[model samples]
Every structure is written in C-alpha cells, then in structure tokens.
Target: MTLKHILLGTIGATMIAAPAAFAGSVTPAPADPVVATPVAVALTGDWTGGYVGGQIGFGDVDAGGSDSGAIGGLTMGYDHDFGTWVLGAGIDYDFADITAGGNTLENMARLKVRAGYDMGAGLLYATAGAARADIDTLGNDTGYFAGMGYEHMVTEKISVGGEVLYHAFDNFNGSGTDVEATTAQVRATFRF
Candidate 1:
C-alpha cells in the first residue's frame, strides 16, 4: 500500500478503537442520594384540670319495696394527675321520681371524692361521697355512697364515661325506714 493509504487506514482504525479504549477510564455518574422517610407517632392525653359535665342514668331504691326509675343530672369537678395516678372531687344533682309503696323520692345530690389510674386515653376510678335524697312525704335525708367508674377522653376537650354507685341511708328523714339505692350512669364532660 502507498503511504497515503497506510495513513488513512491507521486513522480509521484509531477512530474505531478510541471509544472502546477510553470506556474503562471514564468515571460513571454518581448514584442518586438516599432519601429517608419520617415515621409517625401517636400522642396520648393528659388529665390534670377542672371539668364540668352532665350525667344520665337509672336508679333503683330498696326501701321496704324495690322501686327502679330513670335519673338524670348535672355534675362538676376538678382533678389532679400524678403520672400513673389521679385524684379529684366533684358534685352532682339528680332529678328523680321513684315511688315504692307509700314513699316517693323527689331528687338527690352528691359530693364526691375519687381516685383513679391513668391509662393512656382512659381512666379507671373508685369514688366515695355524701349523698342527700329528698322524699315527697318524708322530707330529706343524708347518706353515704360508693362507686366505680371508667372514663375516656374523646377529644382534647371532651370526655365520656360511665359510673355505678351504691348508696345507703338509715332512718330516712327520721321516718324509721332504711333505704338502699343503686345508680348506673353515663357521663360526658368538657375539660379546661
């Protein structure tokens, strides 16, 4: 071959092999940066404040004869939370008309003290209190009461609960009759 032919062939061969020879030396593009996603967590409620609320329930009074009826009322209270435990005081009034034999219960009121355990969004408690009951014929009488209750926070400001209370009164309104009453109530409250 002539010098021109040899030079052209060498240039073509170099052009063909240039890309393959430089392929190993070329640096690859950097990989995409790693991205981390955040995790979500649930929040619990705190119970340490004052509250006002209402309650509705059924009451059964055993005075000579058994008389059961519906009872409803208003309630207000304050509470202090100490981590795993809580304590509070409250007052409530109930309007009722339960009749048995010759006696009729007109209404009732209670002043209570309670202690409970904090369970995330819920509370389990025990209560004891002084109760007053008014009878249509026998006037009014003072008594003692004990109960158990469970309450849950439905929102930051609202709560719902249920309670079962037992009451005892001796010589109701000085009429020489002993009275025993049981009440089961559902309650809703607004917290501050």
Candidate 2:
C-alpha cells in the first residue's frame, strides 16, 4: 500500500474502535442533591412589661453639711415603649442611715416618671418625680427629685442599670433647713 493510504486507514480504524474499547469502563453516576440546614434568625428585645428589682449603692446627703453612706433598695415599674421612646412610672424605697449635723436620716422613697430613648438592648433615660424621707426623730418629709440612668438588657427578662439622682427638699418639715441629697446606685431588674 502507498504510505498515505496506510496512514489514513490506521487513523480511521483507531477512531472507530476507541469508543467501543471504553464503553464497559466505569461511568460516574449523577450526584445526590445537597440538603442545607436552616439558619436561625436573631430577634430584638421589647420592653413593654412590669419589672421588679433591687439596687445597692452609695449616697451623699447635704443638709447644712454632707454625709455619705451606703444605700440599698427595691424598685418596681411598668414601661410602655413607643418605637424609639419609652415612658414609664416607677416606685422605689431605700433603707439608709445617713447622718449630718448629729441627725440621722433613714428610709427614703420615690414616685418617679421616666422618659427614655430605646437603644435596642439598652436604655438611656431621664427621670423626675417626688421623694420622701424619714428622719431619725423627725417625721417624714417630701421633696422633688431629678435624675438620669442607663440600663442594659442582659437577657430577655433580666436587666442591670445605674442612676444618679438629685433630691431637693425645702423647709424640711418646719426645721427651717433645706435638704439637698445626691445618690448613685447600681440596680438589676427582672421583667414579666
């Protein structure tokens, strides 16, 4: 045979036989469909319930002079949130013995209204209200108070916070003395 005729015949025969030679070899099966796990979505907190908690901190009373001591108390409140703003009413009572000028003051109470900016897991608030205190030998006295506080939600039902309050009482029960007091406290609350 001529060289060109031989080469063409060999090439044509190889091409015709190649597919048949590999037809019995392993063929890959179609892959199984992948199943994906669903992801959990994070939810934001809502502060629209009644809460009760306790607090402990230091307080300084300046009636004529100044006296500083430790103070602890219980707090309870109900809050209504309006999107970014919150309005609430609360009551708190403290057991403290702060002395100034040989007189000891004990047992303070407050009826307060709170206005706050909601920060998702936290609150920045301003409070104004009425306060009352019992003097050692003197009767109970009433006053006005103003303060600011910050509270953070530790969980869905738990929160921790702190506040600084200034209280002013004029003519403390006919004693002819005006009382001005400041208190700083750390507090925790449980919501329902």
Displacement of the residue 167 alpha carbon in candidate 1, Å? 0.5
Least well predicted 10-residue stretch by lDDT in candidate 1 = 38-47
- Which candidate has the top score in lDDT? 1
Estimate the lDDT of model 2: 0.90
Q: Give the Cα lDDT of each candidate.
A: 0.91, 0.90
> For candidate 1, what is the TM-score?
0.78
Residues 152-172 of candidate 1 have per-residue lDDT tens digits of 998888999999999999998
The list of candidate 2 runs beyond 4 A from truth reads: 1-43
Off by over 4 Å in 1: 1-43
Clashing pairs in 1: none
- Model 2 has how many clashing residue pairs? 0
